[model samples]
Target: MDRSKYTILVADDEELLRWSIKEIVSRKGYRVVVAANGREALEVYHRDHPDLSLLDIQMPELTGMEVLKQIMAEEPQALVVMISAYGQVERAVAACRLGAQDFVCKPFDNDDLLRRIERILEPVRLRHQVEGLLADQRQRYAIDQIVGQSESLREVFTLIRKVAATPNTTVLITGESGTGKDLVAKVIHHQSARAEQPMVEINCAAIPEHLLESELFGHEKGSFTGAGERKLGLVERANGGTLFLDEVGDMALDLQAKLLRLLENRTIRRVGGVDDLGVDLRVIAATNRDLSKRVEEGAFRADLYYRLNVLPIRLPALRERHGDAPLLVRFFLDRLNREMGKQVRTIGEDALACLSAYAWPGNVRELKNVIERAHILADGERIEVSDLPAEVRGGGAGGAPAGVATATAFGLPEQGIDLEEVERRLLTDALARTQGNQTQAAALLRLGRDALRYRMKKFGMLE
Candidate 1:
């Protein structure tokens, strides 16, 4: 809207027409640069880097179409409007195809010309605004946001740095449901060459099987009963960027084959379309499911597994990264304070110890949620143990009764007992209490099912 900051370049073979256009636009407070031909237009464009250009279809030294092509080659995003006589409308349309923003006829009114210019500049202005917002987000979600000082987390940070620098390596991120797999995928994309482009995401397990294919590979109009218009699939939209497939292990076998084909050939055909369209994008697939076990069970394709496992990055569960809970608690507390408009600056040491001692079934996401809840409930400047969740404060499975001596259920001896034997007994008791349901047992133990399974296997309790 501030025209004084923008400059316009006007190029035409007729000196009178060039001066007339410059005078009309300059009256609106924009600085005007005049050129007699296409060659001079390019010279002025390269020198001044004007925001917009108006060129006549007929010019000396170089034709307007030739100049448009050269300008686009130099600056793909440059805004240019072509001018033509009534008979040269066809040529003007050709200029539009070569990246001209819009065109005005020779008999065009000054008001009409200015309106067209404003319309063209509006989109450019909005795009720049969106780019600024995205830049801020890129900074916020940088790899440093994956907070932890433990060796396991440090190793994950190292792997992310190494893989993010690569251009097209397919990355498979394996972790528990809430272990920040999505965050890892985003960091890789924002750090890659395709950061400027959109990173399209499709949750393979979230959508129904019947619609998932159509969503991934768009359909043409009339391709299906309800499809009324042609659709661009996520693969096509992510052509120059990255496509993140979350919960990919739950994808159907038939869809897995098609996805494998896309990975192998970099081409996809819509469900009812005949033509195969080529797409170039980096693929990052994530899942909490044990894909290798699924393959062994014939539920998942082995070939597809191998393709996706090329650059596997397995995230460590929260419990595996010991001593990191207090760090995460502080980080979340500080963030929640600002977000929730609370004055709670620090957490009591007893509350911090309770949080660190409890097994986090839902990982960092759950920790953040707990901190937010506590921030809202805290009546004083610091979070106390009373502000924590009942399960955490009570230190029992789903907040067992205070009178129940769950910690001493096995009745430890005066002498120290075997830690592994005690853990094995606890795991067995949790399983028995849950009627052999691993999910419920994991909940009772406040552990992720994957973590619980690992311990079960270690104790020879898994069949």
Candidate 2:
């Protein structure tokens, strides 16, 4: 019969305990490596590169905590369960503090041990499945360009597919400024039947209210003083495609009525032309404002809001997408490296930690800008904490003056803290827990190995 394959490492001073763990794990369709001392454990760990480890806390030549530290330094996400005696609970807690995934007493029950292992491995397995799907979507539809591996982004991807395929739907995408609302609109349009046709985008807030109507509906020559010839409006151009109205909440109240009419009747009259032109278009609108509040205050039209909000997609802010920061950072790093002709290959773990913990109110667009700035400032192939923008490295002192309340509300790090140092501590702890395995470290950090490495060097962890 075929069996699932997993590799495990067992390190203990006593041969009996080592053998016990080895036997237990091996019986579960895993290949096992046994080490009698800390030095041997490190050697086996490096040589075997096991998927999981069972480490004894007390060992000759090196303490389990010391071994754990070294393992974490190398592979921040390595899955290692620590073993300690009942009296040595302090050591077990210390191991946890240092980043051990789990701990068990020396007189451990085999079933309980198996259960702990299962709990740790289950998420890893599920994460892998999710990553596999993301990778496939990236290749199949260029979805990877969006650049996030977080569960939140996965849900977003799922929702995009569902909402985009629905015919004749009006989708209102709401998010803070620079959260990639336009990109989401494009992805939806690309996935829909309108892929072959044009996707016309209009920024309602940017355009003057007087000119908006003329832009939406084509104007005939002599209709306006400056009108030179008969021109097709965006609504007419997007007849068989999609029209993305950005900052829809900012549109003038009167124009909202016209938009509502067009959505309901699927027809438009040019600014000066009398004939009504029939259209078959899909509307996908986005706004940074709270339309509901606007409606209550009479700042926005309620009927128009209802018409555009048949489907709503709210994007998660960068802070809410907890584990995606590092992934996106790596992507930006690679992109900047190529564009700038720089060989910057790594970021210190601490620097990455800074980015992960900091609340990016500006979201993905801000992250990209920060990375580009860091790339330009980097003096070597690696990006250092120093390379980060002064605003970020200064712990929000120089940047926009959003107070601690804002940070607390959005789950950002405290203002004026050493972001790089905080990142370093988090990365160090995660690595120590995982026992120096890069792949596991990535999983713990919710990043890819390349991302982890880039950050590791940026924080001055590299030789």
Candidate 3:
């Protein structure tokens, strides 16, 4: 409400009316500028760029409608208020449709005009506040803000940078749970040209199947039970921005078809609505599941998978990103030090070794959680071996990660090994590696799919 920070432009052919308007607004502490006609109004507009413009409907050189059109074309969000005479109300309504934010009548009361301006600028103030918050978020989740330096992580960073430069390509981020897929999505959005706009996210797995279509495409009044009014969906809300679909592999089969149509046509029909609403959307789809495997299993649609996979980014598991544990540990410790008000300066070598050796099945999130627990449990100024959990202390001694025993460690019996059990173990390992995709498992075992399936059936492994 600091009126001094806001400037108003008063454009009228009548010099006396312009001066009177300036006096009225300037008395309220607003910085006021005046213009004699439509042509001069544009000059002042392009030059000073006032926060608001009050234009008279009838003006010399150019009509108010003409000025409105040019201004809107140049700056669509420009705040404009048309001044209309008694007979010019129709023109004022037309001006509203032409992108003027609001319209006021000639001989309008000084107080009423101020009130109208106040109401209009209030929403603008809210929007500015939202934009300021987004600025802070952009700094926090900036592209390079991800904390890691391993070679595998470097590749992901390179892809994120390349993908962010694209204007609006569909992006598919694949990674295990807790591997920061969602964070990568946010980083890409905030680093792109659409940073100033929104990045709306929805977890496809979390929403019920019955309501997901309604949530994504909205519904008209009386479209369904409890449908009382027309509603805009998430796609409409994110029309000018990004829509992040997390766990997209879990989306229902029926919805997958609708989503495919949306991607192909760039339009969506609200449930029970007759017309298709066009949308400009940058879809960033993410999944912890292996979508190729899902497609092979017929649980996910192949065409939709291909559409979403336009620009793919696969995040490596923490254990796969060799030499990153130390860096991540240091980063998390620094943050924990400030957060917990603890002064643990350094971790013992024994503790760091255990962290690096243990297979991070839960990935980076697990590491962060472990670090937090250590910060709380460390007795002295530094973290020692005793501060670590038992699993970390006993893991990774023989080059194999925790909980995974080597074949040599599971040594062949002195008498003899059971050939049947060995075959069963190999079959299970191959299936696990390929997430139950028969063709892929076959390739891994260097056997045909028929042979693999026959063996799996013999062992009661096939459903």
Candidate 4:
């Protein structure tokens, strides 16, 4: 709606026509730059760099066709419209072949010219908007936003920078849940050459086993009972981009084989289709599970594990990073202030000490959640010790543990506690929450039913 920035170039031999076009365009708040001849038109073009140009076909010194050709050669993206008399249809065709966008005959209507100019500039406006949004996104996820100063974190940052420069090298990130594995994947992708393309993400543990295959590999319209139409798989949709497999350790064995084939052969076959389609992309997988352990247990394939581990990156849990608590706290506080529309600007030393003392079982994720909770609880500009959860005070009696996780993850207190006792309690809690449904409880605990049963049987709690 703001037309002030749009500049139009009106080049014509006839004085009246040139002034007419200029007056009509300038009234719409667009800046108008005019040239009396073709020779001067190219000069004005080089000087002003107009958004759109209207040229007279018959001009002294050079023809409109010559000017259009030279401009197209230098700037193929330039928008140009040629002006010709009624009998100059062949010349208009030639102008188009020379890269003119459109042509208007001599004695063109003022309103028609204005409308055409408006239509042509719509694409220019859209291009500007897309560029601006991508710029903001790049700034938002820049490597500096990680917010840490620890040596371990410094090492992780260095690895990220190195691996991001290499395209098509499969990367596997291993760390406890909430260790910012997902964030690191994004940083690698957005920093790489594939940033402009789509970065498709799927959680192998999130989707149900039966449908996940169809979701990843797509399906023909009649592939299965519920499939209504032909669907492009996530893998195909992500061609020339990235497919980030979060919790890839949980993917089915059959799908894992297919994925391995994709990595090796760069081709995918749809669920019920016969033809193999070649795909080009990068795979970045993240998991909280110890894949090597899983490989030993036969739950994951050894060959596939080796393939994915080509460029492995392990993100350390927040507890392992020394003295990053305060920095992370401040980072979340500043961001949460803007999001929650509150002025809780600072955290008292007492509260920060509590955060430091607590084992961040959930790592950076739990810390972020706690900061938001504190921001909501605080009535003043500062978050005091009392604003923190009791577990953060190391009370360990109420609410879920700050970093309380499944069988794979546990928050060990500074003073040692019985590990088996904690596991027994968590199993009981999950079972009770899911109303004694073993499968649902297993999912809630991020464990498979068999794994849950093994723990339950070990404790003689199997009913």
Over the stretch 154-197, how does candidate 4's per-residue lDDT look in tens digits?
Answer: 98999999988997899999988998988899888888888888
- Model 4: residues with Cα > 4 Å off, grouped in runs: 396-463
| Residue 45 displacement in candidate 4 (angstroms) | 2.3
Clashing pairs in 4: 361-403, 362-403
Top TM-score hit? 4
TM-score of each: 0.70, 0.56, 0.66, 0.83
lDDT of 4: 0.87
Error of 3 at 335 (Å): 1.7
Residue 102 miss distance in model 3 (angstroms): 15
Residue pairs in collision within model 3: none
Candidates' RMSD to native: 7.2, 26.8, 9.2, 9.8
Q: Model 4 misses residue 199 by how many Å?
A: 0.8
Error of 4 at 298 (Å): 0.1
Q: Of the pair 1 and 4, which is ahead by TM-score?
A: 4
Worst 10 residues of 4 by lDDT: 397-406
Candidate 3 runs further than 4 Å off: 1-128, 395-402, 406-463
